[model samples]
Structures are given as C-alpha cells and as structure tokens.
Target: MLKVQEIRELIKLVDQSNLDEFVYEFDDCKIKMKKHKTETVAVSVPQISTQAVDLAPQATAVEAAAVKQEVEEVKEAPAPEVKESSTTENLHKITSPMVGTFYEASSPDAEPYVKVGSKVSTDSIVCIVEAMKLFNEIEAEVKGEIVEILVKNGQLVEYGQPLFLVKPE
Candidate 1:
C-alpha cells in the first residue's frame, strides 16, 4: 500500500523538476511514479514491492489458490491460436507513451489484458501504466499481432520504454 503523502511528494517532484519519472526503493518496498505527456494532469503510482504487506496471508493465499485452479483450467482447455514469430527487424515496437509502472492486468487477481501472439488493433488496450493512483490504459497504435512483450509484469517503465514488439498484419 502507498501513502498519500508519498503520492503528493511524487506529483510535486514531477511538477517541480524536469524529470518525467521517479522511482524509490525503501527496504522491502519499491515505488515507481510517472506522468504522461498526453493528458494535462495524469499521475500514476504503481507499487511493485509491498514492504508493509501483512503477514496474515488469508486473502492472498486464497487468491493464489484460485489462480492455480485457473492455470489448471487453461491446461485442460484447447490451445489458443498459433501466431508467427515476428522478426525484430520487422517488428513495430510498441512503446510506453508515458513514464509509469507497467501492469499486465488491472489488478493482481485479474488476467492480463494482452499477451504475446495476441491479435490487437490500433485501439486495443495492451496494458496499464499506473502513476500516482491513476491507471492509464495504454493502447496499441498500430494494428497487428503481438509478437513479443518487452517488459515484465509489474515492472517499472520509463518514458518511451518499449512495451511490446508487434508484427503488423
């Protein structure tokens, strides 16, 4: 969990400094803050490492169990569509339009919005980048099939960071 003061400080930093993104690591916690250039006032704060996480894992344990079940279900289900691997040279890189924390899903308990080999359009939501409490949906600018995901889930991403490599259809 993030503190309100921290978010305020991050937003203040962005407004006061020339830097577009900020990252902080304290003990067991890591916080990433970023602001996109598109929107007038957009702030995202994605907390990757939870230092103050409660040791009582009842809620978390249950969620993990559910996820395991879902994994089993996927294994039992038919395979998804096969997609051709896009060459690096031919790939049109999908980059982060803003500097924030990159998230594969809306929340920890949810499935990722997009994956490698997934078909996507220009308006497809590839992922979400969170800065200051605001979650900004990142869209694919070009129509194509996702070939490779450059960043890992919950990873701290900088401005103009390469998020995915798409093969244009």
Candidate 2:
C-alpha cells in the first residue's frame, strides 16, 4: 500500500514521461494510470475479488485535490499529424526507437556521425540515444543525404520522435 503523497509523486512522474500508461502492484494494492488524448488522465485503482486497496477509504478531499493538481500540470500531447507532414513531404525521417537523451556524437569531443548534406546508407549511424545508462545507436534506415537535424544534442527525445530528415538518394 502507498501513502497519498507517494501516489501523488507517482502520478506526476507518469505525467511528465512519454509513457501512455503505467501500472504498479504491491502486496494487495494495484494502481493503473493512463494518459488520454484529450489532455486528461484516466486512473484506475482496482479492487479485485480479494485484492483491495486500503488507501481508498483514506482518500480525503485534500489528497484528491493535490493529485488532481499534479495531473493537471502534465504537458499536452503533440498534434497527431497536422504539424509533421505539411512541410516534410518526400523526406524520410529517422526517428528515435526509445525515449532517451539524444547525442549527436559518440563523445563530447568527437565529431558528429551525420550532418546536413552528409550522405548516408541504410545502416549509417545517425545518433545515439542514452537510456537507463545504456547507449543505443540509431541508424538511418533509408539511404539518403541528411537534410536536417530535428533535435539538439543532450535533448530528451520521445519514442518515435523524429531526429533527422533525409532526402532519399
């Protein structure tokens, strides 16, 4: 069982992240939270046949308001497709596979793997995404010339977010 403050903290963390849903279970308490497309959070703290949360009975007005405030602070989700395709027609986007920090180079002193006007093949390494202390190399899946770098180094990137634009060969 989690205290109200702890639950509030968890809610804020989930809201700030790129995750669409989060679930937690400890002992007999089960909490599931999902972010909706309408800028609202749908939370479920289920009580199964025998698995009931003890915190439900203790949820006071103050706690509820605090949790609601935390949820309300979440950033809005990006527009579905209106802002992406309008200007990027005929260009291939190299997107991040996982949420992490984007790095243009292997090391701070090293040169970037790809830059604008740089030619690349199907397997060329475009950047690195550092997640959970592991560095994962992102590849240019399309053979092309780099036309734009969408994100800056050290910026946090969401899953499926575009990192580079390529003009196909």
| TM-scores, one per candidate | 0.51, 0.58
lDDT of 2 at 14: 73
| lDDT for each residue of candidate 2 in 23-100, tens digit (9 for 90 to 100) | 788665567777654433753322111111333555676765655554443233232231366668989989888767
What clash count goes with each model? 6, 0
Off by over 4 Å in 1: 1-86
Model 2 TM-score is 0.58
Cα error, candidate 2, residue 104 (Å) = 0.3
Evaluated against the true structure, the overall lDDT of model 1 is 0.65
Candidate whose lDDT is highest: 2
lDDT of each: 0.65, 0.71
CA displacement after TM-score superposition, residue 78 of candidate 2 (Å): 8.9
Model 1, 1-169: lDDT tens per residue?
3344344435444544666666766555454545444443644332221122332333466644554454344224332222335348788888877656789998899999998889999999999998766899999999999988987887656567688888899
